[model samples]
Target: MPHMFTISPDFPPNSLAGWYIFNTWFQKNTGLNIHLNLYNSFEEQTIAIDNNKNDIVYVNPVDAVRLVRDKGFLPIARVKNRLDEVVIAVSEENPISMMCGLKPDLKLAMTANPDVNMISMMLLEAVDLNNSNVVKTTYDSYIIVVKNILKGEADAGLFLAKAYDDLSNVVKKQLKILLRSDVEELYHSLLIGPELADRQDEIQTLLVSMTDNPVGKGVLEALDFEGWLKIENEEMEFMIDLIDTLVPDTD
Candidate 1:
């Protein structure tokens, strides 16, 4: 039997293919029989972690914080292009120059994930938008959220700046960023569960040094990241505090 690692299904199909390629290379280099496990939702992924079914996992910032605080997961490395903040965008033709200019009947589109939803709520609060008047719609992906805005199904959308940058030029021209938040306190993280405690140092070394090889470089390119950076427990304290403040109670 091989060790199983879990990842969130938030990535697009093409991106998932790249991950499979990377996983194959990782197994070849590390001489470990590890399997890639993909879950369809955040809830399912977290449940696997809580049940001690996962060895290593890739997850968003909020889940990383939760797992660290509650499930004894250790943060190892993070994507080099980790997001600093999220953006609120409106269609260019909407005539809304500022977030506050948004009308009460605004149809807000956002991904259903906890981190994004929390940020979306914070952004709405910043503009003093009444919750009652805002029509919130949840989607599976940032691209869908942005598309809804372009198709006139949403008045505005919340997405990471990186996702917006990845949009097509024509799509980019049709949207205007109303505002961007200050540096986010959290980042997407690679985590090691208790099952991999003995192999922590070795795994961390391999991941951080992955880009030294051609196979690793190709994996990084496919994932749209420069490289991984090792993270310390102390470095994640701010993110933990921020998550605690934003969510209050995860249970």
Candidate 2:
């Protein structure tokens, strides 16, 4: 019998497809059984982890910070979210000449849930939230924010790399990049949970040693994962400092 490891997957295409491919590869190469549990939202996944529901999970940067503090989970690898450009979008016609000059009256659309929008808020505070008059537009998902902007409900919107990629030709053409943050060297999608921590060496071996075999290579190709990197507590501490400066009261 093989030790079965469970992963909390977020959504379809990227989440399910990527997990299935990686799970197939991991089992064949390492002889450890792999399973994935799909969730409708990151909220569900985060709760599951807190309740000891799964062995591992794929978390976003914002959630990764929370896991580091609350769950004491170790990061084995980061899913490279290729699109690095964080866009400051305004109405296509607006003449916002500079990043600093963008008005305080700019109504911003952001997700109400912390799991999805906390990182963006952290990024904004790092830039200068005190000076800006940002009206928070709440929604269930980030896609709703894009629609609010197109309909003239918002003056500007914050979006990740993939949001721009998935935009329609018209919407793509309509939006202007008001500003983009400096490139982040590494944005981690950490693997969390107590089970993974106890079996750290085994987990690391399974991820890093994958490329040695044919089956393992297939999963790596699907996930676009180069390999695993052993992240230290000090690195996670840097994120702690950043979060502290942004949301001091609660991590």
Q: Write the residue-wise lDDT of candidate 1 on 138-249 in tens digits.
A: 8777778888998999999987666666777888899999987776566788888777777778888998998898878998888877999988778778779877788734
Q: Over the stretch 1-251, how does candidate 2's per-residue lDDT look in tens digits?
A: 33333443322244457677776765665555666666654456667766766556555555667777777767766543442335667767767755665555668875444423454555556447632457777654556777888788987777664545556677778777766655564364546465557666666766766677776676777766665555566776776676555454543
The candidate maximizing lDDT is 1
TM-scores of the models, in the order given: 0.88, 0.74
lDDT at position 98, candidate 1: 86
Q: How close is candidate 2 to the true structure, as a TM-score?
A: 0.74
Cα-based lDDT for every prediction? 0.79, 0.60
